[model samples]
Target chain A: MTQKPSRTQALYAWLDERLGLTTINKLVLDRKVPKVNWWYTLGSATLFLFILQVVTGIFLTVYYVPTPDHAYDSVNYIMQGVRFGWLVRGIHHWGASFMVLFVFLHMLRVFYMGAYKYPRELTWMIGVLLFVLTLGMGFTGYLLPWNQRAYWATTVGTQIAGTPPIIGPWITRILRGGEEISALTLSRFFALHIWMIPGLMALLIAVHLYLVIRIGISNPPSKDE
Target chain B: MSSHNPHDLSRRDFFKIVSSFVGSLMGLILGLPLISYFVSPALDEQGGEKWIPAGPLDNYPVGEPTLFTFTLTKQHGWEKTAQSYGVYIIRHSDTEVTVFSNVCTHLACRVRWHDDVSEFICPCHDAHFAEDGTVISGPAPRPLDKYEYKIEDGTLYLHLVEG
Candidate 1:
């Protein structure tokens, strides 16, 4: 008679049969890569920052009221009253700026190393889209605080978008919900910041990670090739 | 292979310990703050004391007590709320004034001034207090609360303490 496998081993075997968990571990966590420098870590760093932003942003929504009247005061309460709220918000605030910086740097790294060529071109394209979404998040989130600087910054930002011809004005009106900044504009930006943009970015990030794994990390570019 | 060598094996063990420590450190750095962040609202407290203006001293007629009501706007979380407070003011002179809170000392019900009975009457529980706010006949255990006041220039100011 064969001896029974241990409980954990049996569970793992059962899961492996249905979910192919071992295959996933082998493909994702144990995959081999060519020798690379610290520059390769930039992409992962950006992803880490994105996760941080999502967590802190959700915590903020606990106290954050999207209305213009309450927005500034709510943020004030979070900073002053809520314990460690300042830290959470601080991480999210700095994380946004750093994510933008890291995404740009990661792209620059890929560009310089010529990692965007060949089979990785689609991944590069998706990453570029992700970069645009990152900027979109920053733009929408900047207005949520509704403080003096944020209010005026958004005003000028929308005005800049209104600088073109007829279509430019139309875009501005759509963004602002009218010819000027109003409560509707704030709620619209809030929706996009919390839901729409992040949702799209998450979908794109899954694709980006998949592509990164499928094509595997590119070899450091040779001087000739 | 070097992978099986003792020296390489110890180096790998060192890396495992270092990575685990760093990973746990990262979790601790964020995890503790996150616990506080979620439970913060329960820990919030807002209170203060300040001298609030009760308008010009000339507004109150000397001799009898008059109900003087003032409004205070306070920051309650995200809202600015206007709380109305009242005090019975007895002006002995332009600078000499006695201020008694409109609240009954017993159950915190509002006590109205009865000119005929010459006392503050608490309608909620049939409690009464003399003109000086001493409990006359009721379940009240103490006199009406008094507030400190001062006169500067033409304006009369009263101290507001909140918790």
Candidate 2:
């Protein structure tokens, strides 16, 4: 026959019981985790894309200049001087496009599955804000090249923003730095793109995930039940 | 509950099925690309300064402006993009050359060389520039930007901006 365990082992067992690791495991394994469809993979994919963005973005930030005069040249230097810089830039550019695509798809998945109802409403709202911020990142990054296309596109974009009602002129002036796309505008957009928007995205993502965990995953509404 | 028993797989069977499905999907998504990278020929292109000859010096006659067309091929990371630019090379003399980008200072429209008037005219917004690339009239606030150039063996080589 086997002997009884020592006092130390028994004490550790009691602590584990109080912590309820077994109970948590049962909850995770038994409590339905929505075996919906492949659409659920989108959230995990978006998270993966975000991680890729952060890594590539950090690599780019090491070479990118936020200034107006040198920003374009510095990017060129990276492309010409650095090892595998072109591949890095291509990955960054393509990754950005993919990030936007995945985010939009993720939103659609949430909508179609009715995952944004009730307690997840705030999470949906945060996701929407993150979507807009992603667009902001794209627009701001487009100007960093300082080429003719970048210059003209930014000019047209800011001019369009100036068409809004009351604060149109003020907003355009603020965006362009003086009724037009200038060096100041490039500097401002650089700051916002690299720092401001990324910071907000991180905070919003954290809050969004917190809400998601708090409410847990929503199950599909059944017709027969 | 009794009727649903046949449809439900055992826990071990379910785990086996789900894990294999997920593993295969992950492999398709990630593994194929890694294998392709090793097998691909295009992945081996190096990144460095590529010198493109814009035109022969004789093509740009003295005291006349002409458009020098050249193609720029670049590899940015994994992507290969080719772009072409028509640059105005004004041969002020045999020794002095002024290179102006064909892109209009206003809205980036292509400015044309009007031989009759001896000026660069942008039809988009009526922006005008003299043979020297200074803004002669209309909406262009800045002069046409000039590119750095060098002459070797009577051929004009221009450094195309990369980014």
Candidate 3:
């Protein structure tokens, strides 16, 4: 006859007994997740878009120069000299547009489905912050080109910021780094786009996911409730 | 007295109904796309970047700025890509020329040349740049960036920057 396992082995066996692979597989394949409308997939899509951004962004960082002087030349080199440089840049550019688009749609779906209620409120709020960061990413990324379009767009965007009361001028000054958009502005935007915004977004997204899993999926509105 | 209740469905029968319903729904959703993802790329051509010729110098008038648009293919690692860029070229004299990117310095707004004012203007924020590419009166911090240009036998060649 086969001998029984030792105490430690038995403990491991008991733990596995409580949550066995077969049982986990059953949970995943049993369709225990709610079978909601197609809107339920936007969250996963948004997450996918984020992954794309990170990947493309990393490739872009390889060739992109954060400084003002070399920024334009480097981008040109990528366009003209680098092998498949235009495609990488194009994907990065268009990827940003798609990210913003999908993120907005994701938020709208969540709102319409009443996913923001009660236990999910924090998750929704974090998502809202992420949306703002997405816009920030767009704004900052636009300036990196150092082209006429980037220059003018920054002017318009910053001027709009100047319209707000009290801290408008201060904010503008901080953003521009003096009286006008210059090297300082480029550096500031570079920092925010590459580091600050991405960092904050990652942290917030982690919290958002944690809250989502901890609270479980929110149910759709019922007639009785 | 023994009685049989026909209205009650057995546990196994109920489970069969649920399983079949879920299976059919999943099949309807995932069946087509999963197969396509595996088979599509193999049937398609090997895609890569292509260099497109922009235009010649004769097409651009002297003392007047002209917008040159071109589409170029870009390769992003394992992926293929394409995008369009617009460049504003001004021929100051026969050999002296200046090329300014159409993208505005402020926020990436496309700047238009105003012949009346002899300046590049960004209507989005009223940003202005001189004909020489200096920032004039608007919120723009710097002048428009000049592209590396070459005239080979009168054919104007411009270097495009991928962003």
Pick by DockQ: which candidate is best?
1
lDDT of 3 by residue, B83-132 (tens): 66778889877677788898899998889988898889998999999888
Position A172, candidate 2: lDDT: 91
- Candidate 1 is scored at a TM of 0.68
* Model 2, span A1-225: residue lDDT tens: 398989997887898789986776665445556667788878778877877677667777766776766777768866776655676677778988998999999999899877888878999999999999988888888898888888988988888888989999998999888867877898899888778998899999889876766677888767873
Tens digit of lDDT per residue, candidate 2, span B1-163? 2345877887767888998999799656544544443243344554456566866788888888888887666654334579678888887656668888899988999999999999999999999999888999999989998888888888888766633
Query: Please, what is the TM-score per model?
Result: 0.68, 0.53, 0.52
Model 3: runs farther than 4 Å from truth?
Answer: A1-31, B1-163
Q: Pick the candidate with the highest TM-score.
A: 1
TM-score of chain B of 1: 0.70
Listed per prediction, chain B TM-scores read: 0.70, 0.63, 0.61
Error of 2 at B144 (Å): 52
Tens digit of lDDT per residue, candidate 3, span A1-225? Answer: 498899998887888888795665554444345657787878777877787677667667776787776788778866765555676678678889988999999999889878899878889999999999999999999999999999999998988888889999988887788889999999999889888999899898889876766676677677887
**Candidate 1 per-residue C-alpha lDDT over A54-160 given as tens digits, one digit per residue, 9 for 90 to 100:** 99999899999999878988999889888888899999999999999999999999999999999999999999999999999999999999998888989999988
Candidate 1's displacement at residue A159, Å, is 1.2
